[model samples]
Target chain A: MNLILLSPNDLLTDNRACIKNPRQLAHIKQVHGATVGDQLKVGLINGNLGIGLVTELNDTAIYLDVDLHQAPPRALPLTLVLGLPRPKMMRRILQTVATLGVKQLHLINSYRVEKSYWQTPFLEAENIREQLILGLEQGCDTHLPEVHLHKRFKPFVEDELPAIVADTRALVAHPYTETACPCQIEYSLTLAVGPEGGFIPYEIDLLEKCNFEAVQVGERIMRVETAVPYLLGRLF
Target chain B: MNLILLSPNDLLTDNRACIKNPRQLAHIKQVHGATVGDQLKVGLINGNLGIGLVTELNDTAIYLDVDLHQAPPRALPLTLVLGLPRPKMMRRILQTVATLGVKQLHLINSYRVEKSYWQTPFLEAENIREQLILGLEQGCDTHLPEVHLHKRFKPFVEDELPAIVADTRALVAHPYTETACPCQIEYSLTLAVGPEGGFIPYEIDLLEKCNFEAVQVGERIMRVETAVPYLLGRLF
Candidate 1:
């Protein structure tokens, strides 16, 4: 963990906090080998990032005298609308999106997305929160990315996605597209990426009707895991 | 597997080949559900990529009417010198580099690289080749990236790295640098990335002495896996 993240529940007072989670505790003790008086990077969720003076170190918990002031790094001016990748990739995607400072993520279903994916336990609030927190910790940021799931495709695209794309550059990653994905976009953008086999013809047509222009990354096919970072890096 | 990769021995004649490898056979039958007359994407190792006509399919083997013409996707004009990540990450890195069209990769030792990382069986030739083939299949590419290992840091930096960096834009990813990483460069590059905690000051000094300029990706610290794709996306 790059930053010691504190929730409101961890506060002993306005200035003092204790890390009780074993994950963070083990990381602080074993990975960091932190000692009392060590100044650590600490951030409050949706709050500020600053220094935490390690006041007490023990097996159970590490007490910190907190001073939070600095704002987190600027978030990406992008909203990712991705097909629900296989369950195995879900956790990593969550972490990656969070780490890259993506403020909004929408994992939606497509014709090619397996129905079993929606049933994954990783989608549970606490589990999703854990992955996002891990991602936030990695980025040393505090603002959590808002994740919205759309299990049905048509309604979400026809009713909801247009509004999301109204003020943003809307694009979809498709192999057959002649247009290349643009680089270093400075304004808000809503990008759609599909599942393993990609969005079907009907799905593509629907997206295009909603003002989402299809763009190709390259000639070579990439797994969603690789494609997400690749697209994010290129677009932002 | 997006492409069924073929080796020299797989060719039975100029126009025909049989896949005997159980791994590829199982994948072709199970994942692809291919039958006679199915046209599958196929590529020859270090050769060309094209379509293969499935001529025979059974439990014993699969036969293909081979046609090869198209060249593999252009490789990144980069020689990446990376600190050897832990064993679990090693396999994935090998796969990712190949998938991204990286031609040369050097896995080197560094201050923060655990001593045990170099001992991974995943570093073995057969094990590494398996991962590369999986990557090539995923990317529909023919050429496999060459992976080099450097068990000693100081010697590799002093004795060998100078020549590797001589004709390239020699760079080291260091967060302390003022220069942001250059983008859309068309020339050859040699980039060195340190392991988890990053290179110590002394090592950075040595790299600097060898004409390697330090460049920063961003403020958020990313895992080597994330950084490789991110930097590749930005630079190329």
Candidate 2:
């Protein structure tokens, strides 16, 4: 963990805290290799960044006293609309978009998306939250990105997407499109990416109606997971 | 697996090829859901894309008759020089660069790289090849990228970088730098990325001596793996 993330409720009386969780303890010992008196970068989950001093340590647990002052890390002014990828690729996409600090993510269904993918265990709310937390820890951030799921494309586009694109610049990544994806983006952007085979023509039309401009990265196609980081890099 | 990748040696024999490996079988069953008479996209390792007909399937094995006539996917005119990242991130980086069809990848030592990272199991030749195949399968491409390791930064910069940079547009990504990464690259380009904490000033200077121009993607500091796809997106 690049930053040790703690929740506000974790603090105990007298500003002391004890962590007995196997996951957190393993991180402290195996990842950080922390010892007593070692000050580590810490952040309150959804709160603030701070420093934590390892006041006590043992095989099963560790204790820390924190001094929180800095504000939460600023999120990128970008929202990603992804056609839910395969379960494995979805894991990487969730962690990556969270690390980059995207303000929101919409996992929408497209024609190319398999219906069974919606039932993958990785899409469970708890699992999604865990992946986001991992990304935040890696990026030294505290705030979590809001994730929304949409199963129907038409209702989402005709009802929800208009408002979503109202004040933001919307761009869709389609491999065979005419417009080239822009390089330097100085304003907030909403980027939409398709499933493994990409958005069908009708889907692209629907996105265009919602004000998303179709763009291409290059002639060579990329997987949905790779495209997420690539789009974030360009837009952010 | 988007495409089944086969080695050239696998094609010397004529009628039938048997694939009993768990990984390949699982991919065929789970990802492709292949059945008898199913024609799938197949690419010969270091060769061409072709059609594969699933001739038979049993409890432990799959048989296919492949036609290898189409040419291999074209590679992007890009070379990547990355400050060796942590091994976990390195695996993603290697797979990503290969998926994006980069011609070369250089993993160089930098100040922030942990010494122990060099010993990661993912760096083993077999493991690296596995990741490359994953990427090739994702992109429907067959050519493998050439990977180079440079432990001594100074010697590599002084001795080899000059010829490497000759007649190519070389750009290095460092956040907070002056120039913004350019869009619409139409020629062969080389992109350099740093480790987690980024390259020290001395290392950047040595790169400058080797005619590498420093560029920034944006003000946001991105992780190395994220930066790879982002850089490739902007450049290619």
Candidate 3:
């Protein structure tokens, strides 16, 4: 963890806190290489950024006294609508979107999405939360982005997408599209990307009808995970 | 696996071949969900792409009758110089750089890089090769990018960097720099990124002395892994 994250509830009780969990301890010792009295940057989960002074250290645990007063990170004005990628790629996507501090994420089903992928262990609530937390820590931010899943395409397009696109600039990424994805977009954008094979004609029509202008990254098609960072870089 | 990669020797043999290794079998069954008579895209390692017809299936393995007769993937006209990231991020970086098909990679040492990171098991030859293979499989290409390691910064910068930058455009990504990273460059380019906290002023100076121009992605600093794809997307 680049920044040790503590929840607001944890900070309310006392200024002194002891970290005994194996994962956090390993991170403190191995990743941070913390020595006694080393002041480390810390953030409250959904709270503020501050410095945590290490008071005591051992092989298994460490103690810290935190001082938090800084404001939470500003949320990105982007909402990502992604076609559910393969399990491995999805994990990377989740982390990248979180690190970029996107305001909302919609994981939607598409023509190319494998039915089996939804069952992967990586989609479990706890697993998803852990990945988001890691992304937040790496970016030295605290607020977590909300994640939504859409298992049916028709319902999402016909029933839900209009409201989501109502007040936002919506863009969909397709390899064969003519317009290039813009850089430093001024308005809040809702960006949609397809699965590995990409959105079919019908899917594209649905999105276009909903006011999503089609955009292309390059002539070569990139994997969904790679495309997420690429799209974010261009838009942000 | 998007494509089943094979060796030249495997292609030279007759059409019918049985793949029985634990890894390949597990990948076929668990990842690809291949069955008898399935038509799958296959590629010759460092060579051509073709279609494979799965002719037989047994308890332990699957047999494919291959027809190899297609051109290799287009090469990316880019080289990456990255300060070594942590082990977990390193795995993603290896796969991502390989997937993007960069011509070469240089993992250099920097001030913020912990000394112990050099000792990671993921740096082992076998492990690195495995990640490269995974990247190739995901990208549907079989050519592996060459990876280089530079442990001592000063000597590498003074001795090796000049030669490397002789014929290629070199750009270093530092967040505080004034120049925006150029987009749509027509010629080959080399990208340099720093460790977590970024390159110290002295390190940036050495790179600048070597004809490396410093550039920034945006106002926000991105993690090394995220920056790789971001940089490539804009430059290439």
Candidate 4:
């Protein structure tokens, strides 16, 4: 963990907090090899980042005296609308989006998305938060990305999506498209990426109607986990 | 599997091939749902991509009338120098590099790289090839990337790295650097990415002496797997 993320409940005072979670404690002792009086990078959830001076270090917890002074990095000016991936890839995808500074993520259903994927326990709020927190720790950020789910395709695209795409450069990543995915664009973007096989023609047509232009990355197709970072790097 | 990749061993004649492997057979039957006369995308290993018409299909094998014609997508004009990732991540990294069209990859040792990483079975030729093949199948490409291992860092940098970086833009992704990574450069590149926790100052200095510029992606620190795709997207 790059940053010791503290929740409000962990606070003993405005400046004092205790990291009692086994996971964080283990990481602190084992990976970090931190001891008392050593300062560590720390951040408060939805707040600022700073340093935590290790006041007490033991097996159970590490008590810290924190100073919150620095702001987190800027969030990406993009909204990701992704076709819900396979259940196995869900955690990594959530972590990736969070690490890449994606503040808004919409996991929607597509023709190629298996119905069973929506039933995965990975989509549970607690489970999702757990993954996102891990991502924040890796990325060393404070703000969390908001994830929204839409189980139905057409209704989400027809009703909810238009408003989201209104002020952005709407795009859908497709292999069949001739237009290359634009690079280093200055404007905000709302990008939609399909599942394994890709969005069906009817789905593409519906997105097109919502002003989303189909863009191709390259001839070689990438898994969604890889594609998200690739797209973000190219665009932002 | 997006394309049925055929090795020379799989070919029965110039115009025919039979897939008897359980993996391919299951994918063709269960995923593609192919039957006699059904056409599927096919590609020869390190050769052209084309179509395979199913001539016979059963439990044991799927016979095809092969017609290889189209060339595979262009390979990226870049060489990747990566600190050998953890054993568990090695398979995915190999697959990702291949899927992204990277043809030359050097898995080198770094100060932060664990000594045990060098001992992974994933570094074996057959295991590496297996992951690369899976990547090619996922990417719908034919050419497999060449992976080289370097157990010693100093010798590789002093002796072999200069020639590799001579005709290309040499860059090392370092989080401590002030320079932001460039984008959309129309030139070949040789990129070195460190293992988790990054290269030590001495290592960075050595790279600098060899004309490698240290560049940063952003404030957020990403896992090596995520960083590779991110770097490729930004550079290429």
Candidate 5:
């Protein structure tokens, strides 16, 4: 973990907190090999970046004298509208989105998205939060990305996506598109990426009607996990 | 599998081939749902991209009338020098490197790289080829990336890295560096990325002596897997 993320529950006072989670405890002890009096990079969730002075180091808990000041890394000026991926892939994508500093993510249905994917327990609020927290820890950030799910494709695209695309550079990643994906864009963007086989023609048409221009990266097809970082890196 | 990749052994004649591998057979039958007379995208290993007309299909094999004429997707003009990742992560990174169209990859040792990483069976030629094939299939490309292993760091940087970075834009991903990574560069590049905790100062100094300019992506620290693609996307 790059940063020791603190939740309100861990607080003993405004300036003090304790880390008791076994996973975090194990990481701090084993990976970091930290000890009492050693200062660690830390941040409060949805708050500011700072340091935690290790006041007490024990097997059960690591008490920190907290100090908060600096802001987290800048959030990407982009909204990701992704086709709900397969259950196995969804877990990593959640972490990736947050790690890349994307603040807004919408998991929407698409023709190529399997119905079974929507049924995965990984979509549970607590499970989703766990993955995002891992991402936040890896990225060393404080603000969490907001994830919204849309089970229905039509209503989401027709009624909701328009406003999301209103002032942004709306884009949909499609292999068949003649236009190459733009690079190093300065404006905010709403990027839609499809499922494995890609969004069907009718689905593309629906997205196009919402003012989303289809763009292709290259001839090579990349999996969603790779594409997410690839697109973000290229655009930003 | 996006493309049925054929090795020389699979070719029965100049115009015909048979896929006897159970994995390929299952994917063709189940995923592609191909039958006699069905044409599927196919590519010769390290050769051209074309179509294969299914002429015979059975439990044991699928025969194809192969016709290769078109060239594969353009290869990225990059030579990746990466610190050998953890074994589990190595498998995925190999596939990702090929999928992204990098043709030359050198997995070198770094201060942070665990000694056990170089001992992974996944580094074996046949096993590495298997992963690269899966990547080519996923990417719909024909050319397989060449992977080289460097068990020693100092020698590789002093003896080999200089020549590799001679003409190309040489960059090392260092979080401590002040220069932001450049994007949309229309030139060949040689990029060096470190393992999990990153290369030590002494290692970075050696790289700098070899004319490698260190650059940072942003504030957030990405995992090696994420950083590989992120660096490639930004640089190219």
Candidate 6:
């Protein structure tokens, strides 16, 4: 972990926190190879970003004198509405989105999305939180992304999506579009990316009515994971 | 697989190919749901972009009446010199690079690169080729990226790198650099990306001596895989 992310539950005093979890403890010992008095990058969940001086480092736990002062890095002014990827791809996408500083993510169903993907246990609240934590640690940020799952496409887009796209520049990454995606855009944006084979003609029509302008990345088709970072990097 | 990539061995005649491998056969049946007379996108390894019409589909194999016509997508006018990623990340990087149309890649050693990463079986020729094939299928491109390995750093930089960077825009992704990475460069470019923890000062100095300008991506840190596509998207 690049940053040692702490929870409110880990707080022991006004400026002290104890990490009892094996995951962070083992990482501190093995990956960081940390010793006492080392000022490690530490951040509180949804709080501040600062440093934690390692006071006690043991195999079981580590105690830190926490001092959070600076604000976390700015979150991307974007909301990602992505088609639910297959089980294996889902884990990495969650982490990638979080690391890319996405504050809001909506994983919705599409025509090509497998039915069994929704059945995946990896979509559990705890599992999603765990991966997002890992991503936050990687990106050295504190804000946790709020993930919303939509099992039905039509209802979510027809009922809920318009509001999300109301004030933002709504976009969908479509291969066949004549409009190329704009770059270095700083305004609020809501980007919709689809599953492999992309959204069907009818689904694109629905999204168009919702005010999402289809933009092509390039002639070369990219996998969802690759496309996400590519599009994010270009847009902001 | 988006495009069914065919090997020379799969060719039965001038305009015919048979896919007997369970991997492609299963994908054809399950993913494409192919039937006789259905034409699917197909590409020949290191050859042409074309189409294959299914003439026979059964339990063991799927025979295709092939028609080779169109040229493959243009290859990126770039040479990527990257620090050897961790074994698990290595597989995905190879695939991502190839899918993005990179035809030249050099995996080299750096001070931060773990010594054991040089010993991974995934670096073996056959294994690397497999991932490249999968990438070509996803990209709908025919050319495979040529990968070169450098076990030692100083020699590779001093002896070989100058010639490779001679006629190209040479850049190294350094976090501490004052130069920001350029965008949409149509010229040939050589980009060097470091492993996690990044290249040490000594290594960066040597690279500078080899004519590589140090350019920064941004303030936020990204994993090598995410950074690869992100950088490629911006440069192209």
Among these predicted structures, which one has the highest lDDT? 4
- The predicted structure with the larger DockQ, 1 or 2, is 1
User: Could you give candidate 5's per-residue lDDT for residues A45-125 as a string of tens digits?
Assistant: 999999999999987999999998899999999999999999998878999888899999999998889899999999999
**Candidate 3 lDDT over residue span A8-52, tens digit each:** 554534576677757778888987889988998887778878888
Q: Is the docking of candidate 5 incorrect, acceptable, medium or high quality?
A: high
Provide the lDDT at B163 for model 2: 84
For model 2, what is the alpha-carbon lDDT of residue B92?
Answer: 75
Report the C-alpha lDDT of model 5 over B1-236, residue by residue, as the tens digit: 78889998999998899999899999999988899999999999999999999999999999999999999999999999999999999789999998999999999998889898888899999999999999999999999999999999999999999889888988899999899999989999998999998889999999999998999999999998898878777777
Provide TM-scores for the models: 0.98, 0.80, 0.80, 0.98, 0.99, 0.97
- The CAPRI category of model 1 is medium
Name the 10 consecutive residues with the lowest summed lDDT in model 5 chain B.
Answer: B227-236
Evaluation by DockQ, superior candidate among 2 and 4: 4
Whole-model Cα lDDT of every candidate shown, in order:
0.90, 0.82, 0.82, 0.93, 0.92, 0.91
Worst 10 residues of 4 chain B by lDDT: B18-27
Q: What are the candidates' interface root-mean-square deviations?
A: 1.0, 2.6, 2.8, 0.6, 0.8, 1.1
In model 2, what lDDT does residue B30 have? 81
Report backbone clashes per prediction: 0, 0, 0, 0, 0, 0
Clashes of 4: 0
Candidate 4 structure, TM-score to reference: 0.98
CAPRI band for model 2 = acceptable
Q: Write the per-residue lDDT of candidate 2 for residues A1-236, one digit (tens) a residue.
A: 67877765667743566777688889899878899999888877788788889999999878898888888767887888999899878787888888878869999988999999999999899999888888888777889889999999889989999888888899999988789887667877888999988899999998998889999866556878788887766665
TM-score on 0 to 1 scale for chain A of candidate 5: 0.97
lDDT of 1 by residue, A1-236 (tens): 88988998988887899999999999988888899989999999998899999999888989999998899989998989999989998888899889889999999999999999999999998999999999999888899999999999999999999889988889999999899888877899999999998899999999999999999967778888888888877877
Clashing pairs in 2: none
Give candidate 1 regions above 4 Å deviation.
none
Model 3 pairs in collision: none
Off by over 4 Å in 6: B58-60
